[model samples]
Target chain A: MQLFLLILLGIGVLILQSAFPFYLKVAGVKPDLLTAILTLYAFIEGPLPGARLGFIYGLMEDILLGRFLGLNTFCRTLNSYLVGYAGQWLNPENPWAPTLLAFISVWLHYLFLLLPGRLAGFRYPLLPGIVNIIFPTALYTSSLTLILFILLRGGVSWKRGRRKAGE
Target chain B: MFPRRRYSLFLWMLLGGLALFLMGATGWRRDSLGFLEIAFREGLAPVQKVVATVGSRAYGWIEGLKSWRGLQEENRALKRELERLQALNIQLEEHRLENQRLKELLHFAETQGSDFRFVAARVIGRNPTNWYSTLTLDKGERQGIKRGQVVITSKGLVGRVVKVSPNTAEVLLITDRECAVGGLILENRTPGVVEGSPEFKGYLQMIHIPKEAPAEENQRVITSGLGGVFPKGIPIGVIVRIVTEPDGLMKKAIIAPFVDFDRLEEVLVII
Candidate 1:
């Protein structure tokens, strides 16, 4: 049931990302909500489940974008797993956890996503891609992570309260 | 329960293998739509459309609220603009009719063809990433949209359809790095291939034009009809500047595209 709900949330975030303009985009780069969610989920749930969620969400994103098919899947799954492993030594409840982890995850995600295209002889200006796209996207995703973390945490407490009231 | 480190390694290897397999499969095939992908995208279209509509309405409401105080002034300005446009429209119509009559005479003398058949569609969504410029249109194969069909606005050429589902199609905008168009300079008739410039936003570049070709700044470029992908004579852009490569044999020209991609709302696809 938790997995199902997370999947639904992933879909909703994907739709929102697709349908609307980002509130804080620089150089036409927007925050990646999927990366933020995957990172947060990994921090909360640990490596295996987080990797699974990442794989599913990444696959859906890849299909929806209809560009490179497996690129997101490969990058996101690895990112989630690494975050999950890191989570074991860190506290998820820390306010900075999602922010810092999101920054790292987004950086890794772009590295993985762009490296293959660059290697394929696609001419992405390396310095500009990093400065304009990767760094800005990482900062944007981290900012979004703060908001999403609060919302998810609030949702959990709310659900727990309802369960207590019923009891 | 945490798996053993070796077990985790095995899982990583397994998923890595799967990712490579998918990459290989997708790379081996140039088609974006397989049967399953078509079904998936078709199924997702309604959801995308609904979300887009609701989001747009919400955005409009917010914008309208913010500007409510100036509504009367805005309305008056719009009315004045409409009247001015109406006067210009009358003059343009006369010119159009004269051009059509001249074209008819040319057709009788030279066997010129009719205008292209097109299907109009609304822009539904845009690319989620900044790396590419793609737009999803509400029309698809059901409305005669097909892969490789050229999309255009009233102003000029937009892009080409890259993927089609039952109800939605994805257009690869000409500004994206991957897109290339065969172009002809309106002044000198120099033929070249215009491709999206990676370094510049909202700009295109035509490369490999002969250095001796009299391609000047502000010259108009149009489709050359060399490639069957786009129709002949679609207005592309105007050359902004000529670039001399390190090697002197060929030259590049910077172009400002005719269609404003950022403000695109609707497009007509040449079926």
Candidate 2:
């Protein structure tokens, strides 16, 4: 049931990413909900399930784009695995952890994504893109991560607490 | 704990290697994954279509809420432009009649005649990646929307259909790095290829302009019909700047596309 819910959540995030507006974009960079979700999930669930979920969600994202197949899968899988392992030492209940993880993971994910593309003879404006595009995107995703984490974790507990109070 | 950690690390490495292999192989063996891609897209397209409808409506509401004052200013400007266009329309009608008579006398065929059949489609989804620009349309093979079909709006050329399923199609936008359109300067008839910029999103560049050719800022660029996909005379963009390529043998011009890709809601696929 938990696996099913996670998959559903991943799909929901993917759909929302598509539906998101350009108005919400900062410096032409939109928040990455998938990265935030995977980061938090990895923090909560640990390495194995996190890696698997990342791979599945990343593959879906790549497939949806219909190009550079498996490119996102590799980055997301690797980032989630690392984040999961790193997160084992940190407390998931710490609200700041997910935001910090999101900021760091976005940078790590883009590096993994860009390195392979560069090796394949693709040219990207590495320094300028990092400064102008990638960094802004990471910040945007991190800010969004805070909200998502609160809703995912805090909202659930609040509901439980309310139910206990009602009883 | 150390052994368990070691096993996890080893497994992650193996998965990483597998992903790298897939990435390397995708370029060479695209056909291997074609079926799976089509199936996934088709399966999800219906839901995307519904979601896009609601989302666009919501976006329209938000835009309407914020743009009332701006719309009033725009309305006045449009009225002024309309009066000017009305005068120009009379002159253009005379020119059109003269051109039609000449074409009839010379027995010239219309370039976009029977050969061009258009399939109208709604923009249903957008690619989540920042690096690439793509749009998913709610029309597909069932509607005669095929791979490589040129997509356009009444305003200008939008893109080309890259992947198609039975009920949906993915259009690689003109701003995407992978897309290239055969283009010509409308004023001088200088031929060039309009390609997307990797460094810049939402802008295109027309490359391989002949050396010493007159390329001017704000010059109209249109489809040259050499691509065999896009029809001739379709407005692409205006040349914003002329810059020499690094090779020194050619020059490139930055183009600002006429169509607002961010607000694109619907498109016509030239079947």
Candidate 3:
């Protein structure tokens, strides 16, 4: 049931990511909701499950984009696996955990996506791409993750209270 | 423990290998979509279209509310501009007729052929990632929007159709890194290739201009039609700045496009 809910959430995020960014763009960059959600999920779960979900989400994006078929999958899976591994030691209750993880995840995501293309003789200006796109997007995603973390925690506690009352 | 670790390593290796193979297969461009990809895109396009419409309308309402206080003053300014344009329209109409007569004398119609047929499409969604500047249109193969067809607005050039489904098409905006067009400076007739600049957002760079070419700021740029992909004489943008390359071989002009890509709602694809 939780897995089903997460998939629905992924679809909602994908649709909103494409549609609502027209209005929410800052400095020509939009927050990456997928990275934020994946980071949160991986931090709560474990490496194997995180990597599995990452592959699924990344595959959906790749199919929708219809370009660089495996690029997002590889990047996202690696990001999730590493984050999930690191998350085992960190305190998920700390607000900084998910925010920092999201920031780093998005940063690494761009590097993984671009580095291969750059090696293949694609002329992506590395320095400008880092400054103009990668940093802004990471910052935006991290900020969004912070807010989502608080909201999610609040909702979880509320559900817990409701279950306690029923008991 | 040792066996479990080895099994995990094997899984990682398998995932990596599969990813590498898929990447190698697709490369920079995938000329066509697989059946599954087409089916998914077709299935989701309608939902996307409805969401985009509702979102834009809500955005418009919010903007309207925010600017409610200034509407009367804006309306007055618009009225004045409209009156001036109405007077100018008469003069332009006369000049247009004269130009038509001149075109007949020069047999321009035979040389240029008929005007292009256009298929109008509404923007349904944008590229999900910031790495690419692309928009998905509601009309596609069924509407005769083929890959490489030019997309434009009333103001200027937008981009070209790169991917098409039965009910949708994707346009690579002129501001994206991969897009390039042959452009000419209207004032001096200087020809150069305009390419999207990564350093800046919402601007293009006109490259390969001879160092001695008389290109200047605010000069209008138009499609040169050298490339068969785009029609000639379509307005592109105005040069806002010019810079010399490090090697000093050529000059580059920065163009501010007439189309406001952020606000683009509808586009016409040259069919």
Candidate 4:
């Protein structure tokens, strides 16, 4: 049941990412919601399930774009796995955890994504791409991560409180 | 514990290898979609279209409310522009008629006749990533849309179709780094290759102009029709800035495209 719910959440985020980000873009950059979600999930679930979810969601995005087929899959899976592995030692209850993880995950995600393409002879303006696209996107995603963490934490505590009342 | 650790290592290596292989196979060039990609894109396109429609409508409502005060001023400005255009239209009509008569007398063939068939499509979605500028159209192979076809709006050139499935097509916008077009300055007939600037968002750079070319700011640029893919004489944009190359042999001009890519809702594909 939890797996099903996660799948549903992934789909919802994908829909929001693709369909509505145009209106919400800041400086021609949109927040990377998948990175934030995967970071949060990896912190809670550990490396294996996080990697699996990343692979699934990343593949969906690549297939939808119909170009650079497995680029996102590799980036997201690796980032989620590393985040989840490191997450084993960190405390999730810390308010800054999600924000920090999301910021690093977005930077790592773009690095993994652009490096392979650049090696393949694609001429990308590395400095401008990092400064303009990557930095703003990471900052935006991290800010969003903070809000999402607060909301999720509230819901979890609310559920626990309800369970205690029933008991 | 030892066996579990080994299994996890093997799983990571396998997934990573598969991903790298897939990227190499599909990323280097414009490969045709595999069966799996086509199936997934076709499956998800309808849902994307519905969501995009609802989202755009809501956005339009909010923009309308926000701009209610400015509409009257905008309307008055448009009316003045319309009057000026109407006067210019009459003069252009007379010139066109005279040009047609001269062509008939000279036995000049109509080179542009029957060279184009446009397939109109709605913009349903955009590229989800910032790395590329692309749009998803509601029409595809069934509507005779093909790869490498030119996509344009009434305002100006948008881009070209890069990928197509049974029910959808993808347009690589002219703002994307990978896109380029053959362009000419209308005033001086100076030809150059226009490419999307990687360093700038929402702008294009026209390169390969000889240092001596008479291109200038505010001059209109149009398709040279040198490339067989795009037909000639389509308005591209106006030159906004010019810079001399380091070698001093060439110049590049910055262009602001006439199409509002952010607000594009519909496009016509030249099949």
Best by lDDT: 3
Candidate 1 Cα deviation (angstroms), residue A28: 1.2
* DockQ per candidate, 2 decimals: 0.25, 0.26, 0.46, 0.34
Candidate 4 lDDT score at position B153: 68
lDDT of model 4, residue B242: 93
Candidate 4 segments exceeding 4 Å error:
A120-123, B1-115, B246-249
Estimate, for each residue in B161-208, the C-alpha lDDT of model 2 and write its tens digit.
999999999999998777889999999999999988655567899988
lDDT of each: 0.84, 0.84, 0.87, 0.85
Give per-residue lDDT, candidate 2, residue B170. Answer: 92
**Taking the tens digit of each residue's C-alpha lDDT, what string does model 1 give over B1-271?**
6669989999999999999998888895576668998999999999999999999999999999999879978899999999999999999997897566444434432331257666778788878776778889999989889999988766678999999999999999998888999999998899999988765666899999888999999999999989788888888999998998769899999999998787666677877
Q: Report interface Cα RMSD per prediction.
A: 2.1, 2.1, 1.0, 1.4
* Candidate 3 lDDT over residue span B90-200, tens digit each: 899978875654444235323433787777677889888888889999998988889999998767899999999999999999888899999999998999998888877
Model 3 regions lying over 4 Å from their true place: A119-123, B1-113
Candidate 3 chain B weakest ten by summed lDDT: B104-113
**Highest TM-score among the candidates is held by which one?**
3
Candidate 1 residue B151 C-alpha distance from true site, Å: 0.9
Q: After superposition, how far is residue A79 of candidate 4 from its true place, in Å?
A: 0.4
Candidate 2 local lDDT, residue B65 = 85
Which one wins by TM-score: 1 or 4? 4
- Model 2 in CAPRI terms: which quality? acceptable
Angstrom error of the Cα, residue B76, model 3: value is 37
Q: Relative to the unseen true structure, what is the Cα RMSD of model 1?
A: 36.9
